[model samples]
Target chain A: MTVEAFLPRDTTALALDADEVAAALLDAGVQLTRNGSRGAFWLEPLLEVKVNGERIAFGPVTVEDIPGLLDSLAAEPADHPRYLGPVEAIPWLAGQQRLTFQRAGLGDPLCLDTYRSLGGFAGLEQALAMSSRQIVQEVKGSGLRGRGGAAFPAGIKWQTVLDTEADQKYVVCNADEGDSGTFADRLLMEADPYQLIEGMAIAGLAVGATRGYVYLRSEYPLAAEVLVAAIERAREAAYLGQDILGSGRAFDITLRIGAGAYICGEETSLLDSLEGKRGMVRVKPPLPAVEGLFGKPTLVHNVLTLAAASTVLAEGAAGYQELGTGRSRGTLTLQLAGNIRHGGLVEVPFGVTLRQLLEDFGGGSLSGRPIRAVQVGGPLGAYLPESQWDMPMDYEAFAEIGAMLGHGGVVVFDDSVDMAQQARFAMEFCALESCGKCTPCRIGSTRGVEVIDRIVNGERRDENLILLEDLCVTMEQGSLCAMGGLTPNPVRSALAYFGEDFG
Target chain B: MSAQPSSKSVIAIIERWKDEPGGLLPLFHDVQAALGYVPPESLSEIAGALNLSRAEVHGVLSFYHDFRTAPAGRHTVQICQAEACQAVGARALAQRATELLGTEFGSTSDDGGVTLEPVYCLGNCACGPSVRVDNRVHGRVDSERLEALLAACRQREEP
Candidate 1:
């Protein structure tokens, strides 16, 4: 049989190119099926070998090692080099409570069989037995909040969409994960794509919506391709069609690619983009549930939210709620990035401390420099000094330190980092990407950049510090979207914790 | 007389919708995707399409830093100005990039071989000092990188 290996585009970080290795293997007359990663960035470029009905995984090997690997495979070498023994044997993976990401990095991302093998469609199967309200309750009981920037409760958003008055409603999956450090949405969608599809189908069933749209970011073209294929295969399998699992429910899913705009990750902005308009933040109060996605009632959720929902419905609410800290139940997919060995996706409990994550699992900074501060969340997330490193990764925990688990994307910064520049970037990024929907964001961001520039250059240093704080306050409170609103975090938090840089 | 949405009338439409809630992005995307950037006449079309006053569209068109209202130089060169890239001399590299293009950020050069735009991180932080020519990303960019990038763009444009 011809062998195929599905290599991810972002696998450019690998020590070996998948294409080259696959080619060399092909030259050796060996068949290989390139499967998608399971959000395990560290294990990538993770390779798998088909051993009987089951598949076994191996390294993280480079192009040069392919010849030796193939030779050993032919000889059935007693001990394979770079073999972590087995993927399941890895403590990092075995330790994870993978409900939503169970199939990620474990199977062929596009293969429907691999998914079915791992109990993928079983959740949708179980979901068909229950009414819409029952499904909503299960999600609500799971305490599964939105895994996007804002950790809003997921079930409530569905309930509102269900309650809204619309003949045609929508379920929008915000896969536009534009945060600097966060790759959970991208990796999750790429690896466990079916989980998202199942989650959306369940949402469609819960909210009484027949149509769903996944607004995936343009930066992640491969994820889009894989998801689009999965969605199609799901349609053919009757898991996402007019009659899903003989439940007589009709749901159609479509994937819309978003232009690279950080603002579109916001719910309303995503709606506007979905409607083929500019990606700009909308005023709340009417809220997305009431007036969203072409002014129709819509259920807007992050990729992680939907993936988790699939699991919650598959298992009872109590099963999911049994895990995690108070108010924050269920597992979280923690993406460890930036200047760290073993940089990849990590799934841990909701209340795990940043110390255990960064130092223990992340293996500290890859730069070999001292750890100064870490920016949890994306670009707009707060720059936390070492003092806050002990803070747990939770919704309330982030708030205590003035940070957020915004999409659970953890970006590490080494000692060589300049807090002042990071703070300025927060403002500059706001100025660059701001939709200009409101005056505070449109103008205040520009002003904030100017003030930050003054502070960085040592011009009117003491006087400018006051201006910087004031500007941050205005941007934080007055701006319309999170682009401007949350941009103050890096600046304010950096100043608060690592103020030495300002001098 | 009911105004028709031609190239000229489109400008009026753009002006009208430019100030409405979330107008620039929808307006920008619509104009750019449809006409390959916000053309002057299409401004009114955008205004009419989005339901805003002409002056409002004009104000927004000028307010935001990213919207390009006119045709740009042949090659689009986006410089990395984000901190991760800056840590590796992205600022100095940006200067080299601008000098090679013979124009500053947000402007087209006289030769029109390149148009320089200032962008935040392209998510290639691990490979710092990154730049993008059109949609392609080049890592570890510097003065030599800028020249090489410019030359490559020139080659691609030719037969």
Candidate 2:
């Protein structure tokens, strides 16, 4: 009998010695297959084996646990200390509304056969039969917005690209996920890369584009390698190359790597970087939709948006639309990080509150202290206090509360956190990453940091606080892009919520 | 420090990627991968081959944080100083690294054994205090683990 064992090849898993565990399993007469992460990070290096048609799990495992694990597996698997029963029974994973990440941690991430057996390209097949207009209508009706912080309606962007008359159009996936507390894009790319590839191909057919580009960040070398292999396999299988799936439509994706530039995550800056120029933000008017990427009509979407596009097609617009609250439809891939105990990815519908996500999914602070504040979104996002934790996590809802859910990255902080210091770091990050295209952002960020320093140092605290607010307003209104515009969100939110930290 | 690639190899790298749309970034990446850093001497060659001025090539190279003019140390150790990592004591860890390696961030150790730098995020956020030693990312890193990693770097450097 062939006893099959599965282990994650994810970065976190590999860091915890999943590779060594796999080697040990192989040496002990077990067939080992490297799989993607289940996103229950606390239980990572989570080993699984096929038992009576169920994937029984044992995890947070080390090489030392192998002998005893195998002994228990042969006799009574429940007897092992690391055993966690069947994987599906784990409440952490079972609670998620995993649409885009449905097939994560199932089998070999590079295995096309495994992907096909588990309903991988069903959406692309559905799309192959539909008209571009009909596809656009389905997407528009689904209410899917860009998941890369900017909640722009994706269908509208696709419609504009389709309506425009250009010699050539392109589909660019902004995989430059530079957000600190977020790894959903990297996880998607590394675990189920074909989903992103399929989504990009669908975008190509919908927008009348023949080429695509995935501007992946250099930080994610693992994601880069996986995407490269996946794109090649997809092209070989006729899912990504000229004449995709015998539909007479041509769409090929080129993987581009971004150097360490946080500002490049901005679309225009990303375009400039892609064109082999300095990553400076461009003025809006010809908005990338009409004139983009080599001065042609281009459809740009986040990795999650494109992946969700494929999901919308496979699961139908109404089915997805029925899941979430007003405007915000379908699921939100909430990435719990920072000082959280149970830090991982949680894909749930929109109405879930911050408090619920923090308590239920994150399990509060990792340090076992009372949670003080949480930063929603990336560095530019606001730090909400405990009082506002009950608010829903929808984009509109967050915006109403002087906050914006840029990306669904919720970073927890314990009682020891200094809101004043966090506010300063926000300005510091902006000053470092500003593209220098405009004055307000380029100059204001540095001045803001200085002003905050004065306030924290008790140098006319009241006056400096007022001056800091004015600086924030100038950056918010005068800056060319969100790099300067949204820097004030965290600063103002911290000052407003935790004023004591300033003095 | 690693030896710089010859001009001929640099031109070959540029020639290989000049035709593709937005090929300069890829060419730079390939050159860095092969030569350890973007050699200042090769800028004129890259500019000429790509039909851009030397100023333009230099601007592109300098704008990105990744493209370095000088070669890095034998091993690159990047500690994540982003908010996610900071919440879990990355600041203290970075301080510990600086003290142990006897070098500040963005500087090579005196022995040229390790280059310590600060990285924003490695997309391993769920596991806080992530560090990347070369291409492999290690998570849940404490000061002790960091010291061991640095010691390993030094051991590898020895004959």
Candidate 3:
């Protein structure tokens, strides 16, 4: 009998030597098929064996454990210490809504047959039946917004691109997920590349765009390879290129790799990088929706946003709109990471609180120390203290508390963490990554770092603290893009919550 | 110290991508893949072939941290020093790695065995402090794991 097992090809799984484990399993004469992770990261190198149509999971497995695991595979009861029973029944994964990431940790990442069997291309098949206007209406009615931290309504951007009378329209997916502690974009791209391709293709159909681009970060080499291979397969299968899916529409995507600039995560800077120029922020008024990518009407959406597009269309507006709460309809792929015991990807409805993510999903601090602070969003995101742990994960709720749910990456910090150093690192990060397009981001970031250093050392404590606050405000209000604008978020939050550290 | 990708190969790479609009980035990736780094000599050739100036090519290469103008050592060891990695004691690991290697970040060892560099993050935040040996990333690398990895790098370097 053939035994099917799921093993993640993700960076985390790779770090745990999942490849070596696979090799060991093969050498031991065990037949296994590799599948994407189940998002139970604490248990990664999480291997699952198929039995009776359900997958029994085992993990945090090493090459050392493979022989024993294989021996028990043919045992009467199929009992193993690492066995976690059915994958979906695992409490950590059972609770996730997983709309955008529906196929995230399941099928063979590189196999088209696996993707098809798991309901991958069904959305695009459904989308091919709808008119562009109807597609826009469905998306708008679904209340889908940009998942790349900006939180702008996706339908509005698509509509603008649709309305614009450009001879050439483009759909761009911002896969430059530079935010620390976020792997959802990488996970999706590597695990389910077709989901993104399907969404981008649908976006093209909706916006009259024949060409699409995915600006993938260079950090994710594995994801780039899988996506490129997947796109090639997609074109061969007629899901991309001329006459997609027998429809007369032509839409194709090219993968553009980003160099090591964090500023490129900003949409305009990403465009500049795509043009093979310096990744500097561009002045707005004519947003990318009006004039973008060689000054054409471009629809720019985050990897998660575009990946979720097909699902929105597949289930119709009402099915998607029915999930989540208030204005934040639909699920958010919350990346629980950093110094947390059970860190991994957790996609749930928008109303889940930060406390639940830390306690329930993350299972508190990894170091056994008390959890002190958590940075929501990316590097530029605010560092919330324990006092604000009850804050809901919704966009508006976070905004009300002077925080923005920028790309749903929650980086936890144990009591051992020094907030002063974190704040300095934030400034340092901005200084290193600032594109030098604007004065505040370029100069203010370095200046912010110097002032913070002074505060950390024994300088004029009260005055430098005031100066740091003022510098943060200037960067926040004066900078042209989020690179400089949001650099102050972490700095200010560090001061507000952990003021004693700064002094 | 060794042979680089021939000029013929570089030209072929340029010809393959030159016709596309804004194709320099992808072309650069191919060139880097063939030759470990984008040699200065090839930059002028690429610029001339692609209808771009030398400054434009240079600007593009210098802007991204991934593009290395100089050739790297036999092995490249990149340690994650970002906030997430730092929270999990990457700073100490980085210091120990540098101390053991007898070289600092962005510098190669005396024997030219390995090049150590500091990367922001490697997307293994949950399991970091992470380090990358060549292209493969290893997470949850404590001092012992780092020492072992460095030893492996040295062992690989020896004949």
lDDT of each: 0.73, 0.91, 0.88
Q: Runs in model 2 with CA error above 4 Å?
A: B1-6
Q: List the residue pairs that clash in candidate 2.
A: A149-A406
lDDT (Cα, tens digit) per residue for candidate 2, span B84-159: 9999999999999999989999999999989999999998888879999999999999988998999999999789
Q: For residues A412-435, could you state the per-residue lDDT of candidate 3 as single tens digits?
A: 989888899999999999989988
Where does the lowest 10-residue lDDT sum fall in candidate 3 chain A? Answer: A76-85
Q: What is the lDDT of candidate 2?
A: 0.91
Writing each residue's lDDT as its tens digit, candidate 1 over A1-503 gives: 44333443343232224666666667867666566565555555566665444445567766777777656655663367855555676776776777776766665677888888888877788888888888887888788888886888888887788788788888888887777656677667766788899889988988888988888776665676778788888888888889887777899987776666778788888887666566678888789898887778888888888888878887778898888897788887777766665566788778899888887787777667877787778788887777787777888978876888887767777788778877777877877788879888888878887887877788999899998788888888988878888888888988888888875
Which candidate comes out best when scored by DockQ?
A: 2
**lDDT of model 3 at position A164:** 97
Candidate 2 or 1, higher lDDT: 2
What CAPRI class is candidate 1? incorrect
**CAPRI band for model 3:** medium
In candidate 1, stretches whose alpha carbon ends up further than 4 angstroms from where it belongs are: A1-16, A50-59, A75-83, B1-159
Q: What share of the true interface contacts does each candidate keep?
A: 0.05, 0.84, 0.74
TM-score, one value per model:
0.84, 0.99, 0.97
- Worst 10 contiguous positions by lDDT, candidate 3 chain B: B1-10
Residue A306 displacement in candidate 3 (angstroms)? 0.4
Please report how far candidate 3 places residue A174 from its true position, in Å: 0.7
